[model samples]
Target: MMTDQPALPAPPSAEPADRLLADLIALRAAVLAEAGERLARLAPGGDAGAGIHNLANYLALRGHDLRPLQRRLMSRGLSSLGRLESRVLPTLDAVIEAAAALAGAPSPTAAPDPAAFFAGETRLAAEADRLLGEAPGHRRTRIMVTLPSEAAGDPGLVIDLARRGMDVARINCAHDGSIAWRAMAAHVRTASSLTGRRLTVLMDIAGPKIRTEAVATPDKKARIAAGDAIRFVAEGEPRPTADAPFSAVVSLPDLVTRLAVGDRVRYDDGKLEGVVESLAPGEAVVRVRRAKTGGVKLKSEKGLNLPDTALGLSPLTAKDENDLATVIECADMLGYSFVSRPEDLDLLEDALARRGATESRLGLVAKIERPEAVRNLPALIARASGRRPFGVMIARGDLAAEIGFERLAEMQEEILWICEAAGVPAVWATQVLEDLVKDGVPSRGEMTDAAMAARAECVMLNKGPEVGRAIELIDRLLSRMDGHVFKKTPTLRALASW
Candidate 1:
């Protein structure tokens, strides 16, 4: 964005961003060197090769620190623009700068209101009481599944996951109502009490799913560049397309007040990211700007995001209100999705407090999928601590979409670091076993991904007909990691260099 300071210098040539990544391997060593000997000793091997192990470990935890690596790469684009004044580009310096800004930037998936964020955390904490906590103190990769409707519910899936090392269960509020959940609650009680194994059920109330009301045609892999304009409905209208596609859509005028020209908006926790290009009396136009991975994308069902600064929408939706009545439950943990402000938590406490679920006994997990959510994490934690001890899930699917597919890895790690510092139990969610569950076979890359997630308290997987098998895959990969402990943390540098 800065003006050219001088005539362009020749770039390294033809290598593209991959070359920048190669340079980062060297930078990783340099950064790890800053850890000094004792911490350095923590590296898998004794030599500089240890940096690779630590870097892999850091990368695996999916923390925020690796952001530098990404920034260092994207800023490479600027270097191609040539010298800034008389200074030669530092290899891929500008790419790194952009990656840094992009990576470190708050997610467009956030709600503009601070109260709403805290409220979401508190409410989830209260709900988390019903969900399970980190068993004592050790973090394990857990399998999450929904139980059948009643005590007679098909629990073979539940038993299978447990036998295969499932640590948690989830009850989606969208499907079957409270009757189903009550059965699930009873079933969980029986299984855990009988096995003496702690089983947590997460109550995921389908909170405010935002989409363009009118149907929009699915794009075969979509692209939304900056400066493009897209249409949105004020309250949403029927469209000729089966689904409506835009950066986002707002039904509430209150939400409309939140926008400005450059503010970014997102949908589906961040499967879509766009900037507001302009606004009308009731509607605003937000152009799509980023999508990390390619997929057949559609906007049939809506999702939430921070489209601008002035939104005053309440975090608790009508659906949330309806879901709360029957599902205000006692669980080992609770997850507040699409949260952005503290007041949202207070409202939650008020809603469930009389049921006496004030978030104190519960394990609250905030799903940090938005930029503002990251910014408000400290307050969210404090509210959770004061209200109840809690945890966080760096919900990565939309998170990567919101932040930038490229920086999702780093942003997640940052969330982990912050949560660990506060002693909050963290769950790494979305796409852990995606390749395996989605494709019925694990890719070498995803295999490594699961092994790395072993560092976190919990790793979540989407439901598949073979969901239990997905859990088994995580166990299998992690088991191999433990078996090969000496080599599991191998420094790629050593093997490759030698």
Candidate 2:
């Protein structure tokens, strides 16, 4: 061991905070070096600009303990990564120099460079380009339209959408069976071939969706009013006699056991609200708190959400496995629903492997819609990087409900940043231009939302009666916004006077 040398003269401006930052910088460098080595071993062919490996390696080495530091940085409003890197590197180096002088040791000369810091941004644009492909005329962003069941038989509609600048056709497996799915895929393929437009077919697998099961009522529906009590019984449990005016069974029987009293439950995407009043072994009673002006109609197969409960249900279901078999056969990309953890990714990979579908050929799009998914996003992306052509879908509907209505805006921005850091494509999804699609007229707010969605690699539009018009509007809007904005950076494009 070397002997300790005498202390040198203190720097002109040295503070305790400076010393702490310097130590952090030094530790960061060591960790980065180790992470770099691990990345090479893990994904030899991964892009250097793809920062997922870097983040993954760090997480593997240090676990989630350092996540607090990341949160603190975020809380301090370091939203612009470009700005954050520029400030962090220099400050860290200054601390290193001061610490070195005080300890009478040689300072670490090499620090994180600009190339290292901005690799994620560089790779993000590249990956997004690859996934969305180059669109015509003015826009870089692509349009993805969800296909209705009619599109399966309506070749004209498919062709029309393709001509209107729809880069992707999304088939939701939740509504239709395999027969309808095959018909839709065929139409899309034929449309692509004839139109000479490269349109991708994305199939969404419906995961364990908690929904209201068959309700035995005279009108096949029950009107629920505020302050009304209803019992959610499991499949095997007998419905309580005279339990309010109506009762319904939940699709997932296991969920009945998991719910606790006082948990807030939502129906029809929170249009109807209730709180659990009591719980039994396989049933629970909920008191409705909110409803429509006259009371809401409760229908079979409507979505049910328990926001205030810690759910133990896995994201996967037997139906998902059956659906994946069909998805693997036809779809270019698979949209996974309710994915909350990395283990869910593992289950998907295993299923794909068993079906002889390699990660390189098929694309995986993780649907971020749960509070748990939001918290574990970095790890999810890191795990996803192990596979090729992975992307993220910001399922804003369930996400908004899960995290609460108040936090949705900030949460979405955070998701965008994490996706950017991982160098993956993000699909801005759910209720985009809803009024325009449903009512054949655009809302001022929705038009603005569509413009903001232009920042994402792809904008997903749900099926509507006027969906074709919605596609045309989205295409034109994105084309105009493309020249004005590129991701988070604004491009100073000249405004058209026309």
Candidate 3:
């Protein structure tokens, strides 16, 4: 059993490092105490409020970094830091006392009341809304739609989306050039003006995307079935055809060399699955495990997911740096992708500072797609929250692939809970009502998925021919579900009479 006693007090030390440590501890205590006072209003005995306070303190005592602790409390409970201090302040005091003794200073008592930390909860929420250009009295969640490439030059289409309920317009930086991005922003501005509604433009930085580069196939598509063997070769290597068909090359050659035998590989958004059967210096042989009757076609530029291997690559690529400049110039918000560590957020902040951008004013939506990002989410959001108007995007497609399909639902819920703990909004992204947007007909399953997405602070629709109708339908469903469910909170708003 763990003992309740504190470690024996350290011998008095006059060293400079000891003094610095004491100062840091004092500063941290002050911050915590201030937070405690602010959260005191939440009523420490209240069921929900007390749980948040306890978790907050629990994380603080463990000396976990600010972000990870915040995220843990968030994923595990509710309320932001201010409300979290009620339970954490006592442990915080004990920690401070121990540090003070170690530094040879008089042992300090409990922290001052938490009043200094009492910034209202609405303060941060309002800042997020402002960054996203959300108007007063609008719905709690916003609707964002990825702009079709053609929409850059079509002001009418942009305007139509705004009229139908597009609160934020997303421009994927990976696909188009600066000219196209500028045009899309201009069209969105025009539409906002014509419709007398403001729309925020969000540009996504495509970070180190690994994809199938090309395949040695005459028909430009390679079909594979369960039990088929395929060779993954590095570019310029001797392309060896399998007994069933041809080999495929991946965009990132290094990943090919790194694949280990038995590692699971998924293609085309997890539609095709393969196991690495053998490995070579610049190639791997894979045995297909999942495929349709028509067989899965391996196409150029489709995403490749290696769930079991550590991908050795920088999170930020040269392409991302070039895109950041344009995003800063033309977008209200920037979507950060492939982030795996707190240092990655630090890199982004450094870049923003170097570019003369107002870091705090620009909305930075962190895309949670990788396992590392999820594990480090609390710290990620903590770092992000310190630097800018922050939110999260549950980038479900790659996320589902990264963590495995079986755990996608649980992962999404944990992400949502963590975001709520941080008190920041989240955007439910990828393939929401995909059929409805692409084919102008909603599938029964997708319709249910859309309703589920209403729980998030925002729902994103990928650009498609029928996105306008998709937005209309989404708006109607969201309106119906508004008072019924919100982030696990049941609303008792009166139902409409038939």
Q: Which stretches of candidate 1 lie over 4 Å from their true place?
A: 1-139, 146-153, 193-196, 216-229, 236-257, 267-273, 288-298, 302-304, 307-310, 325-330, 480-498
lDDT of 1 by residue, 406-432 (tens): 787777766765554344556778777
Clashes of 3: 5
lDDT of 1 at 267: 64
Write the residue-wise lDDT of candidate 2 on 19-90 in tens digits. 544645656576567766756644456664346554544433353254434443334332232323212334
Reference-based TM-score of each model: 0.63, 0.79, 0.76
The TM-score measured for candidate 3 stands at: 0.76
Q: For model 2, which pairs clash?
A: none
Q: Quantify all predictions' global Cα lDDT against the true fold.
A: 0.56, 0.75, 0.74
- Tens-place lDDT digits, model 3, residues 288-330: 9987678887677889888788886777788888788888888
Model 1: residue 436 alpha-carbon error in angstroms: 1.4
Clashing pairs in 3: 37-114, 57-88, 67-378, 67-379, 68-379
lDDT winner, 1 or 3: 3
> Which whole-number lDDT from 0 to 100 does residue 357 have in model 1?
66
TM-score of 2: 0.79
